[model samples]
Target chain A: MGKWIELQAVPGARDRWVRAEPFGGTVSFRRPEMLVMVDHAFLGQRQPKSATASGRLDPAAPYEAHLTVGHRCTVGCPGCYIDAREDGPAELGFDEWQRVLDKLASLGVFHVALGAGESTPLAFLIDLAHYARGLGITPNLSTAGLHLTPRLAQKLGVFGRVHLSLDGAGRDHMRGRVGFASALMSLRILRAYHPRVGVNCVVTRASFPGLGRLFRMLKREGVVDVELLRFKPAGRGAELFAQMDLTTEQKRTVVQKVLQLARRYRMRPRLDCSFAPMVCAAGYDPTRLVRMGLAGCVGGSWLVAVDGRGCLSACSFDNTAGALSWSDLGRPGMMTPFTNWIDQAPSPCAECRWLQVCRGGCHVVARHLTGDFNAPDPGCPLVQAQA
Target chain B: MNRKAKTKGSVLSVRTGSNPNSSSLGVDVTWLLGGGVLVGLLTMVGQTLTRWALTRAKSKHGQMD
Candidate 1:
């Protein structure tokens, strides 16, 4: 009988490998190229190494669909990423949203994150969540918590997780009028029925200082996980860049502070992939970075976003460049051409050592700053320091 | 400050300076540059300076300003 070992990709470099043995085998090795599987035969039976696995990517599907079911939002935070407005386009009908869910399910997507501007019709959101669950896709939601009534909260019990946006400790001022109270009420209501409740905070220069207090509040409110979203310069957020964007020194400080706070809190910390370059620039070791769950930019590669209009973007923040409409997906090949476009796209930061993880930072930031999505992210500490 | 007051202060202090409590005068120059107003002013100054230099050279060569 031969013992089997599994090899996984290293943290930063995609080609590097480390052996992982499940059956208590202690064989340790690092190879320049990815190794599929190797067996050691004890009965003198020789077996050829499986080289076919090297050519194939992971069999598990890597894509998660972030679907914006509605375009209207009433909260109107100052640096709203989607620039969601109360008067935004009406939401797609229930049937249309159901069809979209079916298409995502057919594509082997096991997870879907439902989002809206704010004021998404509660009935439509509930129906969509039910439809997605029927297809065996785990449904999650991100909301501003404005219209999360008790009835709506009961309906949302079907969701796997609910992420409430809490930009700062002071809710009303950081969010909008009555935003703070509403979010808290919603959190309390959701906690009564939902087991997995999380907070999504946007990290900016101003809010970065108060994150510890914010985390303490979330922990008190029974939040199980916290996702620290990097502030991207897009939509109305671009207007506040000068005031909110962290400088190189501030970025280093922010990363260190976040790591410290995350360690102190009981909540699980997950940072946006765009912040990977900042961690590397702060001189954190690769092992520490990987342990922090800071896998580089998975945008266009592992995740994709579908906006309220059924338009596809590499990520939610990247709603501008290379966006494909829902009509485009109806074509014959089915996402092959889209995936090829994302993979074949040229980026100036492709030669950087951290390219695999950073993926040239967020495309939205690059496009906003230099008018070219292929340009290196201007906010990247490495890019800024070099320039 | 109490937690509530501290949070309120932070929210009200979303301005362009390291000292969130300081008056508007503490706003940094980088913020101005980001707003593009400074860049536009610099471009205008550069254009005016070039025109003035050309006028001076022509006068030295006995041409009308």
Candidate 2:
């Protein structure tokens, strides 16, 4: 709600361009070109983003908040930031979720991303999606797509979009939880729907070689967009950093290759380096992706994770404050105390080149692996564009 | 903006690539000025005529003109 506005892509335009009136401007239509270009004052929201309208939103507005439905996760992926060592139960109840939605609504938050723990409870998620949509807020969910059955996918049609994680082409890196065939089957099921199907590929030692191949397959399969996520050295991610982390040269090569692949295939791939360069506004960015023209994680500040026992944590980053209940939030009257509980990250990440893009990597991951979320990121090599 | 003339000449040129006069296409400002001015004038006239016609029809139909 700061000085920024979010624009969403509507499916019908042949060129598929979205525009927004910059705070006080009007939209202009050019008949000959059949193109609508807002005056110089407006901002362009769609990609192959216009360089003219690029500027930072007022940082004062709360950035996007990433919320965890529960600490429950079945997968024991080695690099997972949210993996609970033991099988944690789904702690969030419908009433608590409703309250959270109401709070976000009151704040005029436009985007809310629900991840962490599996989001397979269709009835609950559908209600949540409907609630967000009712408030004209966009609700995005990141799922393994392991349980995205036909019926479930149809139900999820209410949400803005779903970004399914596909770390590699085969089950080689996915361990045993997400079979490649199963993920692809789910993709095929989702492709027949209205919402976009985005594939998230985490570039790691296990999946690096297959990145190009995955892009190729997505293009071959006629998928419109994909996301290349740079792996952060945090949580279980830190343990494997020695093997999974790329050298500066290799990182450059990977970015170049991915850029080339995207240009060649005309496939829209969002480069997510939220875990790199250490400092991130992930927990601070506004969730107005649908209302404001900005992208990336939005409304991540109002987000908090409440466990089955009603214990609160910033995210999955443990050892900071094990499990404080709702009563411990703050001075009796406060709403979002999770933002205060998270420690501020240190820099060159603070003054990094990609600071504007990646506010800071995940705090939980940074804290667990390096014991300091503010320190310069070791994974920043991947965030740099290959000149 | 000299290249603007070249592009216009290329569009109007008989043999786009084969013409030896391609290098001199930039000098052909006449086409650009003439065509551009004509377009502008036509747009104004077209708008004016459309408005006039609409007004006339409205008045004839005893509606607010």
Candidate 3:
């Protein structure tokens, strides 16, 4: 019952959201939450072409899985969640790792993510990628890029997407904090293989002011896609308000700048807020890049993540967010936090103006920061202004 | 014609009413509703347990020292 929204653009830049005069709002499908609502209500509910003529998928479906090769890291960033769990064991066994992957395949998994640690062994990671490819699964790996050696990169070059952490320019800002240089070197090697390489830039107190420099460097490196991760205070990073919490107005300015930069480099920058459109939950829907997040969950069980100790979690940040644990992995029909959310997200979130669109802010983020899943979305400024 | 009639008679016998091929119709609506409530309660228990576990882990394993 909410208004339909769309993307409006400024001259020389790509279209953004602006209200259409008579319709009273924008007119683009960029807002999937709103678009999905419109398509179902106003437009007749027709089955998608991807589905069978009968309007459902066949019983036999394939799924993707996530494998956490090792849980060891060489660097300690100021706000990293992995660093908080440094006390855990080193890695998951090869066979146990395979079991996680096989489970994903059984569930129709198509995409797999590796790493929440410093280095997932070059040999084991390559083997996993090769294995995923053997099963026709796309393997995506994220790294601080600090420990990625030239030799290792050349060897494990075949991958779906290699996300390198490029926090900022110069050794001073990136060195001990987020390990950007090693990630750069790794990115260079990955480029030799010509796999799709994207940069994960964490916007924090230290790196927010360096966006201009960071994007320029990315352009020069021939990187086209960048994922901007907003800083959420979790784990050791939870004390960030004292150092780097952005005010509402500041975040708006930053979001606008990010959009401008996206146009400048002709590089697609996906915001966790924009791309995901909902709060992520751990362990409910097993068939998405994200299990429980609204839009970002790779529908069809695309993305899966496993940690070093052979623990299965929905997202890399799952441990910090506090959802289902490693212990719940093999149970037949265990009740996961995600399934409950799917069934019982509160009324305000379920029936809100943005519910169909935003998927009720990230629960993990909500729980960690505000202690409530029903709290106002941190992106309230953008969501409210649009409607 | 007699075989067709017998087949229809058997089909009609399976139905509660005399509608041949209608088959049996039963709704276990209570079980579905009951499962929903059970799931909700279990999730609350899980969250409370997880919070407690994380608090304990944070105190024990969640530090830089």
Model 2 lDDT per residue over A171-225, tens place: 5346337678878887788777745666666677667777777877787777855
- TM-score for each prediction? 0.68, 0.60, 0.61
**Can you give the lDDT of residue A355 in candidate 3?**
43
Please give, for residues B15-61, the per-residue lDDT of candidate 1 as tens digits. Answer: 11011100000111121212345434433433333234323433554
Stretches of candidate 1 exceeding 4 Å from the true structure? A1-62, A171-173, A284-293, A321-323, A330-351, B1-65
Chain B fold agreement for model 3, TM-score: 0.42
Position A309, candidate 2: lDDT = 41
What is the clash count for each candidate, in the order shown? 3, 31, 23
lDDT per residue (tens digit) for residues A34-62 in model 3: 11111111111232444333211111221
In angstroms, give how far residue A329 of model 2 lies from its true place: 9.7
lDDT of 1 by residue, A193-225 (tens): 776677777777777777888888887887756
Q: How big a share of the true inter-chain contacts is recovered in candidate 2?
A: 0.00
- 1 or 2, which is superior by TM-score? 1
Q: Sort by lDDT, best first.
A: 1, 3, 2
lDDT, candidates in the order shown = 0.54, 0.45, 0.45
Error of 1 at B43 (Å): 56
User: Where is model 3 more than 4 Å wrong at Cα?
Assistant: A1-66, A84-87, A171-180, A273-304, A320-336, A339-351, A382-387, B1-65
Error of 1 at A110 (Å): 1.3
